[model samples]
Target: MDTFRKFALNIAVFISFFSGLNAQQTYFEGVYSEKKIIINNPLSADLFGTCIHRITINGEIYPFNISDNYLEVDLSLLSIRKGELFSMTIDHESGCVPIIYNKNDFKFKEGVKFISLKADGNKLSWQSQSEVLLSSLLLELKFRDKWVKIAEISSNGMGNQNYEYIVPFLLSGKNQFRISKSNTKQYYYFPVIDMTEQHYKIASNSVTKHINIIKNNKPAVTCYELKDLHGVIVKKGIDGTIDVSNLKNGFYKLYFDTKEEVIIKK
Candidate 1:
């Protein structure tokens, strides 16, 4: 009788522990093959009856209803290319919105392509091949002097994969150019003057060219070739100007004769 009682107590303890675990946020990692979709509640507690939920894609929000164990989210709503990063959020019992899943680990296949950024006056237009309805789409804009962000608008999926996005205003100065994207973390510094005309030109010459060393007026310790490094070697008295027009956009460390300078080739 004592052994039977002990067994019952052990089972009770196990059940209690299991229930506690289910009440917390869980991280799930998996891949969807053959277009198979799996929908699971992110909340620790069981969702009973009808629950209202929102689906955000690229920055647009769509409302949906959760009834059974599976929430059938239409893949067509995603308009995802072969290997694009897709994410969704869920409302929890604590009233905190949490990211349920993101395709950060997925890679695009051959036929998948994303809409490139188009420059428009002070705004950017992003068009996709499929219509995406989302709760929010974060926009990150880069300027010559500083970076600014603006939440423009939201809309429902009209079964078309095109979207027109516009930035609020220019950052501040005259030489400032803006590049924008949906992801706030990613930064693009390319110079875009107009989007309506799709005219994007490199801002190489626009960058201030000056030599900055550890000691501005000190003697050189070592001599290295500037061309050897990843920068265009614009000789002091060469043709028209330092033909860095071909250099890819980014920060490059340039060494002139014995003086080393950092050049931002945007």
Candidate 2:
């Protein structure tokens, strides 16, 4: 049974009174997944064939069928994507607000847990307690002020599972790491990890021949990348000196170790 990547379907019912005769609203919010979820009588209580005035899903009215005072909710009829915000409001008699019977199914499954995420050397490792079958987990690292997917791992879906991925190199300063199932918004964010060791300096912001990096007031060899204003990497390597003479005269981003600088070729 290949289940979904652990998403939540929330159920909330708040009744408002309007002289005890007006329609009340019930709301449901959650993150959607691909797993086929067909919950019969999700409200647990049978609704009167005509008591339900209207039902809306994601701000749109939802069509439903009622037979023998029973309302069936089949979400598969809609084109909902994973991590998409799902909200539903039902307008009905204030005396009869539908209650969710399967609210437990709208939360993380039993034993599915996010233990810890850590980075060691050039590798990142994390663990989780999982259900029987789950999708692969994504590894995202904050790079250049953006979250970039560096690696991914197929989860074991076992009890107390461990996973690891080797990174090419660390960002060289304060950076963040996280893991997620499918949605980028839904993730386990780790604490900031500072890899900055000694202070580094650029010899010149406007270069004519070469760019020299100084660490602790001395020439330092480090991994560096040079990108144009359009974010195109023009040059990258590991050296204490970068020959920018070949680069066109323009503004360029310099990523030296953990520090970033802007340089002009003049």
Candidate 3:
């Protein structure tokens, strides 16, 4: 089938699916929250680019640019109520795409919850009260036009999900850290301190997961943590060796105190 025909068929099928859904169920109520609309069998970025020209939610149309895999939209102005049938149509230059998603696909949470945050010299720590797994907490600095993530720490499981991170070099004045659950929109951010003096040395072999850490006169913590790019904890230790023998070949960070070393596992 031609590209236009395939797109038309998809939209038709999508609309038909939603038309049959129970009219009592409404997905996008007029609640003010950031929600992600994940597309099924998503089109290639190369083909559609990042922005969608227009989005028809119910009968209202809005324009938005998708920055990543899913389209992020605000559900504040949408008149649709919960327990009612909800449908959206996205118009692109190539084709008009329609999608019907259940509540399971759209991820959203209402307001922000406060986390206990503190800074002690080059270290930062925070705690969560809920017994829910959260995404890795990321140390980030504003760079150019975007916030560049410097390091990640896992926040999985429940109870007092506390974490401590040492600050590396502050690349920019605007620095903040954030933590989130894997798929939910609930994220917590903490402001970071930009330090001028180096308190410790964090070095490691570029090819292996072994890291060498040394603290000067500062009272540094003995334990260390390992996290992937997404802030997921791979491993942690309090002993001498920071091992990554089981981890696959990828870039990782070994964090301790206010120091972090990048490790490229081979």
Candidate 4:
């Protein structure tokens, strides 16, 4: 994977497509000192097959270079000076889905190279280089328009590293994830990864042996915590279903995503 240099982008604008928002966020802010806008498609294809997209910055067409990933635009060529306010947008074919890594993308060090950030189920996997200055990292999620710290990641304290962590509790809809160094004057962030969404409905409240969850009429990945009548948590996990065959017949409170329900066990 290639590294996109000097960052923090207007990421909230790019995620509107995935969140199914009717009106997209327009990125109209002063340009960062960033020179290159790099994107990675993550699909294996021939160099010649690389897609060519258009970028309109301040209503002017800006040209960029393409590679195995997505595309990289050199802002320097556009004659846009630092601190100059600019509005940018990307245009592509209907079937093409090119994410904006430059949008809402920024980091701590200029020498650091962020390789990639990916989401699988409820776990987040990312890789980075030149992390010698970092001691520990804090993972933050965008909630209610504010960035909130949810987990602390221990850095390897070495350059060129890869790591992963499973989120304890996640929201049901689209979420943005950001990472920052702990207890530092600078709270820089890497490009935000759009976290997974787990929207599920109880297949049944009459718990016979297992509680099933489904999304769009099929099994769905979910984050849930189950508590007994006494308000003591008995089970919690990220899975598609809950098993409670051994528990004695009684009423239990089921907590999932953003909803709570009272379930009857037979």
Per residue, candidate 2 scores C-alpha lDDT tens digits across 1-266 of 11211111111121122113465666775544444333233332233344455556775445544221455554545666543446666666555556555554444342345778777766777777643335667777776566667666777764567777776555566768888775335688776777856577798898898999987788887567899988898987667899988878989999876688999899
Output the TM-score of candidate 3: 0.29
lDDT tens digits by residue: candidate 1, 131-155:
3334334454433223434453453
Of the pair 1 and 2, which is ahead by TM-score? Answer: 2
lDDT of 3 by residue, 1-266 (tens): 25534554465555444332221222243222235454432343346443233456766553343334355554444544332244655544333233435445443332223478766665777776643343454555444344445666666444445677776544323345565544455666666655454455554456455555545644333346778999887876443456567788988877654456778888
Which regions of candidate 1 are displaced past 4 Å?
1-114, 129-135, 152-160, 171-184, 187-191, 194-266
**Per-residue lDDT over 62-133 for candidate 4, one digit per residue giving the tens place of the 0 to 100 score:** 544433465676666556754344667754433345665765432333233445777766678788776554
Candidate 1: give its CA RMSD in angstroms. Answer: 17.6
| C-alpha TM-score for every candidate | 0.26, 0.38, 0.29, 0.37
Clashing pairs in 4: 7-106, 8-105, 8-106, 9-104, 9-105, 10-104, 11-103, 11-104, 106-189
| Model 4 regions lying over 4 Å from their true place | 1-127, 131-158, 161-170, 174-199
Model 4: number of backbone collisions: 9
- What's the CA error at residue 167 for candidate 3, in Å? 2.9
Global lDDT of each model?
0.38, 0.63, 0.51, 0.60
